[model samples]
Target chain A: MKARVYVTLKPSVFDPQGKTITDALQSIGYAGVEDVRQGKYFELELATTTPEATRSMAADIADKLLANPVIESYRVEVV
Target chain B: MRFGIVVFPGSNCDHDAYHAAKHVLGQEAELLWHKDRDLKGSDCIILPGGFAHGDYLRTGAIARFSPIMQSVKEFAAAGGPVLGICNGFQVLLEAGFLPGAMLRNRSVRFQCEHVFVRVEQTDTPFTLACTRGQVLKIPIAHGEGNYFAAPGVIEQLERERRVIFRYVNASAEAVESANPNGSIAAIGGICNEERNVVALMPHPERACELALGSSDGLVIFESVIQAIRSGRCAATLRHAQGRPEPSRGASPPAAALVQ
Candidate 1:
C-alpha cells in the first residue's frame, strides 16, 4: 500500500517562506498569484493491509514523525 | 556540582557548554554521548546547540527519541534541572520538556548576532542569580529560533512567570527591532511549570568569557552552580517552598526594590 502525508504550518502561525515565494512570483509578473502557502509532502510504502489499518498507521506515523503537532497540521491520504 | 552536556551527533557547542560549566564556572562537567544510557549522576543537564539528527523533519524531532534522551527525560521528570540552548531548546520542546515550538525566523534567514535579552523571571534554577530586568548580551545563531505557542498557552506562561528571558534593546525595552527571530513576546528563554527545565534560543555558553564580547553568560551558569551549592534547585525547592507552585510574581525584582 502507498500513502501520502501533507504537513503544513497551522493557519495561525506565520509562513515567511511562503510569503517570500509569493513576492518572487509577483515580481516575475505572476501577480494573479495572490498568495502562496508552503507545505511538505511525504510518500510512504507500507505492507498490504486493510484500508482502516493503513489510515490509522499513516496517521500515527504522521503524528509521531512526519509532522509536529505544535506548529503543523497533517493530512493523510491512501494513494 | 556536576553538569552533564548531552552531545548529539551534530552538536557543535558541546565543548563550549563544558568550558562554561567546568573551567569558567569551576564546576565539574562531562560530555554524555547520545548513545549512552546513563547520565553518570550529573546534577544538571545541558542540551547544547547544533543540528541534531540533521534536523530532518524538524529540529530535535529525531534526536528526541535517541537513547540518551530517554535518560535525560527521566532525569528531568525527577525534578532535575535541564538547560537547552538554541537547537537544544528546539529539542526540549519536541521532547515535551518545554511547551511551544520553533518557527523559521521572521526574516526567513539564519541569523547570527549578539542581542540583548532581559531577565524576565529569576525564580527558575537557571536564573536565580539574575536580577529581573537585567540585560545580558548573548549570541543567537539559528534559522528557526522564533518561539511560538498558542495564545492561551502564552497567557498561562506569562501568568505563571515561566517566561525566563525576553529579547530586548540596550535600554531593556522589548521592542520589535531588538527581536532577531520574532519570538512571541520577544521570548529568549522559558522554563517549564516545574521551573526546573529551561530552554533558550540564545547561546549563553558562548558569552561566558570576557574575550568573547561579554561575560553576561556567566550569570546563568553561575546561577545554576550556586543553586546546586546552596541546595536551592529542583528537589530541594519543591519541599522548602511548601507551596503548590513557585513564582515571585507578587514580589518586585531585587533591582526594582533598590530603585
Candidate 2:
C-alpha cells in the first residue's frame, strides 16, 4: 500500500516562503490571490498488505518523524 | 574538563568547536562520531552546526535518529550539560531536547552576518560567565533560524527565566528591528529547566577566536568550563552563589575580556 503525508505549518506561524510567493503572484497581475501558505507532502510506499495498517503506519511516521509537532500539523492519506 | 563535539555526517563546524574547546579554551576536546554510542565520559557534549543528514525531510529531523543521539539523549536525561549550536540547535529541537522549532528567516533568504545578542539570564552553565544584560557580538549564518514556540511555552520560559539570550542592538536594546530572524521574543538561545541543555541559533564556536572578528563567543565556552570546574552542576551554581545575583560592573567587550 502507499500513503501520502501532508505537513503544514500551524495557522498562527508565519510562512515567509508563502508570503514571498504571494508577493510574486501579485506582482505578476494574479490579483485574485489573497494569500498563500506553504507546506510539504511526502509519499511513502509501504509493504503492508492492508490499507488500514498502512494508514496507521503512515500516521505513526507523520507523528514521529515527518512533522515537528511544535510548528507543523500533518494528515495521512492511504491509497 | 573534557568536551565532546558530536560530528554527524554533514557536520561542518565540528572542527571549529573542537578547536575552540581544545585550543582556544585550552581544554581537552574530542570529536565523537555520530555512530558512536559512547560519549567517552565527556563533561559536556556539543552538537555543532551543519546540515546534518543533509537536512533531509527537515533540518535535524533525520540526524536526530542517528545512533549517537540516543546516547546524547540519555546524557541529557542524566543532567549532563549539552550545547546545541546552529544546526545542532535544530537537532535538539527535532529530538525533543528543546521546546521550540526553527522557521525560515523572515526575509525567506539565507542570512550570514554578525549580530548582537544580550544575555538575558546568567544562571545557566552556558552563560554563567556572562553578566546579565551583557551584549555579545556573534555571527549567525542560517536560512532557517527563526525560532518559534507555543505561546504557553513562551510564557513558561519567560516566567522561569529559561531564556538565555535575545537578539539585541549595539546598545543592548531588544527591539523588533534588532531581531534578525523574527524569532518569537527575539530569542537567540534558551535552556531547559535544569539549565544543562541549551540551544542557540548563533555560531559561538566560530566567534571564539580573535581573528574571527570577535571573541564574544568565548564567554559562553568559558562559562561552561567554569561551571564544570566549580565541582557543581551548572544548574546549582546559581543557588551556590546565594540565590543568583547578577554580575555587577559594566560588561566589557569580548576582545577586552579575552585579552
- Fraction of the real A/B interface contacts present in each candidate? 0.71, 1.00
- State model 2's lDDT: 0.88
Off by over 4 Å in 1: B234-259
User: What is model 2's C-alpha RMSD?
Assistant: 7.2
Error of 2 at B208 (Å): 1.4
Error of 2 at B215 (Å): 0.6
Q: Where is model 2 more than 4 Å wrong at Cα? A: B234-259
* Model 1 pairs whose backbones collide: none
**lDDT per residue (tens digit) for residues B125-222 in model 2:** 79999999999999999999999999999999999998999999999999999999999999999998888899899999989888999999999999
Docking class of 2: high
